[model samples]
Target: MMQSQHPPSNYQNNQQNLDDFDEVWVPNPLGQTQGPAATSGLIDIIKSGSLDSLLTNPWLVSIFVATIISVLIGAIATILAGQRSTELTPEQEAQQALLQKSQNLEQTDNNFREYLTRDDNNSGMVSNPGLLQAATLEAGARYRNRIIASLNNPQNPAYNQHEELINYNSEIEALKRINLGASGKEAQLKYVDPSTGLWVTIPIDSAELAASGLTKLNIISNSRRETTQRFDLVTVAQNIRKILSEVKAARLEALRVKGLSPVASELEKTDWFGNKASPSEAEISDYQQYKPEPIPANPNTSKQTQDKPSPKPTGGQDDK
Candidate 1:
């Protein structure tokens, strides 16, 4: 017997087995005794360590973070670029302004044409009531001045007693019929106050004055009588017509030069007078409702109305 240091029977056998197992010590590479191995594969080391003990590799984290940052930056840049592209630049703004001006001119021209045709029931050849009045007053003053000058000039046949005087008196009488302001004593009393016994002037409305002026001119133009000197009056009227045509043509040219063709064209074609020849209610309504197109450059491509002087009215009642 081996001195029986071990327990008898199977107990001794079990102890010997335990001792053999204990003597066989296996080496652990990750254990404290071996210290830490050079961490080569980061994934493997992380998998082996405790949840909290695992090292946070900045490089790996940075890769994912950088990708996200790049994506965000790209998104912001795209939005800014889109915004920049859609915005109107200064050149575009200028073009738009020119276009608008052309349109306005066209509308104005259309209205003028309509007034000239006398299509609207209103008189004085102006679509704008206020403007018509002003024009009337201006014409009245001009005619008065011309008459006075002719009378004062000794060289003028109408200075003392001539056909011109008779014509002038007739024109004056016609103007008085279409008077914009009160006539005779009423007009003079405007500046005087009867209630206060003081000199109080009542200011005339600008629109009213303008209408008066235009009315005077219209009357004078319509009241021309055929006389031996009718040709002279015809020449004067023709000159005035030429001046008006020149002004209109210049305005159209300006619009065209500015590249506002559409507007200018609209203005050129516009008829200021509604259908005066046909007095249908529907036609009148249509004229009132009509809105002219914007002005385009070169509104009138066609030749202007014949500039030929009108034939003088027969003098002395044709002596037939």
Candidate 2:
């Protein structure tokens, strides 16, 4: 194999390469090795069409710069995307879970409200505030159960943690129950009957009801008799009715004593707890329509008027 005796001038710069030969390696696109051109050649490229032309052409320059910027931005975006994908730390995950749980709880609360609305729709008119409250509570229990069932189902949006939906603060839940008219732990509630102008007291056990979380609760009806917590609301209402009946009977007796015509035969009579506290429509109509007899003048007053007569015609002296 024959090797060159001296560096080929086309392949080397002997003058510049006085010391290191390592600096003269060149890059070629044709798959062949070459020598570095004179640095002057780069000046020519800058001054003429090679690099100068691209720099001079505004559109080409813009495209090139924009392409470089776009590539840089894309690379940065990819890195950011990767970082974001891995950014879910334990604390972040917990916060996200808590937010989702709160949303689920709020949704459950709305459902509970809807259930209360349904309870109000029932044919039974809960006339008394106590009755309305009790109904809300009964319906809240049913709503909670339904929420549990939905959460357990795979198709449910609140799936995987049904109980969390109902795990609200004790006081908050109690307030909701009361707002919805569920008798959640309230005691000594008073309601006034429209017919009778008297307030009826409702009783419940405070400590027991407060602890029951409004989900399940019972309280004494008697404020004084805390030991006897088993009185029924219906019974209380009945007693109120009886009291009202007595008041109506008293009113009827007054009318009877005044010699006023009775509105109804029943209106003139007292029937204790068995009777209604208010007059019937027919009785009310009769009372409005009937005319009472006028009171007779006192006989003694008329006799005195007669006895004091017989004054002589002395008008001038009387006037003086």
- Which one wins on lDDT? 1
How far is 279's C-alpha from truth in model 1 (Å)?
32
lDDT measured at residue 288 in model 1 versus the true structure, 0 to 100: 18
Per-residue accuracy of model 2 over 21-111 as CA lDDT, tens digit each: 4222344434455544534444445665576655665655777799999999999999999999989998787666656655555565454
TM-scores for the candidates: 0.23, 0.22
Off by over 4 Å in 2: 1-62, 78-82, 118-320
Q: What is the number of backbone collisions in each predicted candidate, taken in the order shown? A: 25, 5
Per-candidate RMSD vs. true structure? Answer: 23.2, 29.8
Extract clashing residue pairs from model 2.
133-181, 133-182, 133-183, 205-219, 205-220
Q: Look at candidate 2 and tell me the lDDT of residue 233.
A: 40
Estimate candidate 1's RMSD in Å.
23.2
Instruction: Give the TM-score (vs. native) of candidate 2.
Output: 0.22
lDDT of each: 0.48, 0.46
